[model samples]
Target: MPNAEKLRSAARLQYKRAVLWSHARRGDLVCRLMLHEHLADPYPLYEGIRAEGPVYRSRAGVQAVTAHELCGQVLRDSAFGRRNEDAGTAEPAADGPPAAADAPAGGGNASFLDGEVADHMRWRRLVAPAFRTRKIAEYRHRTEEVAHRLLDAALDRGGDFDLVTDFASPLPITVISELLGITDVDVDRFAHYGLVTGRAIDGVRSVRQATEFREAAGELDAMFTALVRRRRDEPGDDLVSDLLRPQGDERLPEQEIIGTCQLLLTAGFETTTNLVSNAVLRLLSDREQWEALVADPKLAPAVAEESLRYDPPVQYSIRVVRDTLHLGGVTLPSGTVLMLVLGAANRDPDVFPDPHRFDITRPDAGQHLAFLSGAHYCVGAPLARMEADVALSVLAERLPELRRAGRLRRRPTAALRGLLNLPVSSGR
Candidate 1:
């Protein structure tokens, strides 16, 4: 999604017919919106999708799930599979996941990095314990420390620098790094791999642009192989070590464990980074909201909540149907792809009154689907919220005069929404 307009214009559209032999295409059956259309804001699109009905059958077997009622059903209900998790990277081309072979030129967000649905219940089980509600509380102090350290560096330098590189990217990386006990060597290695991973799997980026991404994935696998070996011998007080520890009778494979850790680091870092940056971007543009948070620190959390609803870091997600399920007037057969418009749905008026308003005090702010729903909902949702809440509180408290330095640059990721670089003036 780095160059959205370019990617949109360049991608060759492949239309699929419902009956294969028939002219009835999925795109023709439902309201289809290009990935770019939802860029920046997608509420109007969501409203339109919602009006179409609960179950919208589009061309190419795509079922557009818009309303909170249906979205929640698809996510929470047991009828759907997470889509990509179980299927691996090789497929008959649905929502283009990172292909099995990362094209030699691939370097941007792969097709469906975050949307891979694998063992929703088991996947959740393996990771939920680490990021559970109770455990997330313990990371606050560390999150605050990391946020302060990054903010201090940015504030003290007193010069123009990208908030993402200078702030957002580092903030969450540092926290997760320390949590995973990754330092020095592992840090840089993960940083590079993280960027590659971000662009390759991010729904926003293109498939061919992720050449470096596949290379990084290979390197990451090798690195984790070494790390897991070390952790097995000498366990550390970090996540990787815990994941490697024996789990009764369900011992995790080194690769799967690596994938799990890599997934966490990639997902955990960018999202929180995006959350911090996106919230900062929204606040910087709205003078009143910025001033409100600076005045009343309690409003910081509210600001984070509202930002998730307003300009969420991660946008839409895709789900695959397991069996023929009836929704609205349509009955989608198994393998029907459902594109969940998370960002658009958050702004749906039917769900939230004055959907366009970014009111921090709005009670509906918490009701947004930014973290998603059901078993596959983001495992680190609580941790992400806590991290942002703490980071924003610290940033507002420390650099009270922070203001946008220039036109903030957005990270081209449509899925992970936020600023790639937000130049801001602070400490004066």
Candidate 2:
């Protein structure tokens, strides 16, 4: 009885629903990657996406959610699980053994990100001490010293250079590698590993495109196996030693320790790397702020906080649903993946005044969720802070005539947006 027009409408409706439920396409790597950089500058895109609908299960079927309050709600809610999900999940506790079904296959790449919730929680408990406030404070002087040395050498060179390469990206890697008792291999190689890993695992990888991931994951696992054994045999006075030499039966199992080391290396190294790069890009864009920092190094700490707010390191993190959730203006179905675009949320005008403006002097600048909210917060937050403070102070003091040479280019990774190469010149 239906006419051709009605038949076409029905077909369109069916297609729409089909896109929302299919996971086969969700595993596609190349085509889905077109959305990578767009998600990097996600606010404007998110605004348009939000207008269409709060939650849109993509053609790939991985649900993407982008709103301020909604992000907070999802992240804070425990029911929005990250274990055994359609999209992906994180290892249960950093230091606990892998879950029953999610055990390391030994041969294949392990799904370290997806495991039982309790194991994830246990992992979180074991690694808590190393990232605690006091521990980070102890590392501050050293982080600053490294930053000062890098910038001072750049100033001594007295020529055009890339901010990201010369200083931002490498500094945090050096600091973290030393802290984790990882020496022998070149720091620069690990820096490359950090960048590649951050780019791959942080949803920047095409779910289908995991070849690079296989290589990186394998090398990392092999590297960690050796490191873990080394720690057990001859522990040092650093984080690895702490994890290896935990109090009493508080020790982590071998597989759990491997996963934890991988997480810590990635988290501690990459997060601060992006943080430093993001801050420098913000500074280069805002010449006045750059000049101000050059005038007073004291502004370093506050400016670093503002950078975390203005352009955070980790852009979007995902949470899996265990219960139906209502947030912002949309209700998410149980078991769906909710993508929390922190960069977009940080710019939410509801929470921050003139959220778009990169104002270091802004009083409420520190309130941003750059370090995240609640229990799953960043453990290396203080170390990141110290690293930035030292680096910024050194840049201001040493590079008096630090000025841009070319347009800043951001990295391709959606989850961590920072300069790939920020060109600048200083007076010789």
Candidate 3:
């Protein structure tokens, strides 16, 4: 059965790839987006897509929208939903890769993102308490402490350090581990799992990757299942424990709890790691921005917001039409998938003036759709923002002379834009 599933997955991927190639040959903006060269700087390609007007029909049989107003309307409309119109035909979301949207239990991270509307709300209600404004504020001090400690170690190591691996990565891993009451988890092993699963944001491109994703999912389930059992036996003052608290009829299913844990672990660190790395890369590239930040470390929050607007961590989000609807001056039938290019929308000149400029002082940068919009907005937005604000502030204060020490290696994924290795000097 597993072999059969793998074969089916392979066949689906090949068909998609072939479609992309065919449309790319005809200069279809949407299909050409999947090309490797566009990964480095896709903004120009987005501009081209936008030039075709608000709605673009690709030979691949889907419509894409890059205009800010249309993208916002599409996202805010209840007629569009996260699930594929045809459940049997799994399609990757626009902003992310092939997620386990409706995989069965013990299959993949059973995140609320994959759940149906009601199930999503139930699961979201269970986890939303941990990310509330007050709860997020409570996490700020620990975030700062973690950031400072990681920087300390990086600086103590002398010359140069890979910020992504050493600092950006570990800080979030530690924070999320503590938040989830996971005491025995291996940080590096979890990081590996995140990378393997994170690649799915770009869809499963190969059979080997699909196999690796399944393995990673199984391993995470096993770990989270063990933790769930342990917490059931002896609960503590943590998110998982709070979740396991006796709620009578409100308690979540055991598998749901495990799935939420897996999702948190997978998503909790990966996006934030990219956000920090991307922000630092941009800041250093514009020496004035970096200097301004160093001179007034209070600008860290602004820097974080602008980074999200200028170069968001998640570039696009896909929505499937649930009913026949007119959008962006085009009529799309039910079952049609619409790709919302968030990175493009954020820089839409109609909304944000001089969209490409990375100005930390951009007053309304917080208006970007980087976290998405409407129903599927990121629940971790507050936590992520808090983490980045602290990370940037601490880096500026502690390493004012920080400079690039080596090459920046970007992760090879289109949906999730982030750095794999960013070497930098501590200027000690």
Best by TM-score: 3
Pairs clashing within candidate 3 = 94-318, 95-316, 95-317, 96-201, 97-201, 97-202, 97-203, 98-203
Task: Residues 1-428, candidate 1: write the lDDT tens digits.
Answer: 36775455345322221133232223332323433344555556566666777766554346667676667777787687666345554212323322221211122222223333444455456567878867788888878777777766776676555677877777778787777666663444555665555554442233454435557766656666778788889999888888777777766666566666666677778788888888888788788888888888878889889999887876666777778878766778877777776777787778889888878888879888888786667778888888888888887787778878877665544445666677878837
Question: What's the C-alpha lDDT at position 217 in model 3?
Answer: 78
Candidate 1, which segments miss by more than 4 Å at Cα?
1-38, 84-87, 90-118, 185-192, 202-208
In terms of lDDT, the best-performing candidate is 3
Candidate 3 achieves a global lDDT of 0.80
How do the residues 1-428 of candidate 2 rate in per-residue lDDT, one tens digit apiece? 24665555456545533443343256422113324536446556655555655465554434555557777776676777654355232311111111111222221333233444566566667667776777877877777777777767876776888788878877877777787788874666676666666555443223222344446667878988898788889888877677776666566777777766666676676777778777877787788999989899899999998988888887666666787766555676776655565777788777889888999898888778888665566666877888888888888887877778898777766566776788888765
lDDT of 3 by residue, 1-428 (tens): 38898788678778778777777888987667765458889899999989988888877556778888888887777888775735533223322222322223234445677665677777778788899999999999999998888877777788689889999889889888899998876878988887877666666678887667778878878888998999999988888898887565788878778878887876888779889999999998999999999999999999999999999888877778888988866888988877788899999998999999999999989989988777767888899989998999999998889899898888777667888899998776
Task: Report lDDT (CA) for all predictions.
Answer: 0.65, 0.65, 0.80
After superposing candidate 3 on the true structure, give the runs of residues whose Cα lies further than 4 Å from its correct spot: 1-15, 88-106, 246-248
Model 1 C-alpha RMSD vs. true structure (Å) is 6.0
The candidate with the higher lDDT, 1 or 3, is 3
User: Comparing 2 and 3 by lDDT, which wins?
Assistant: 3
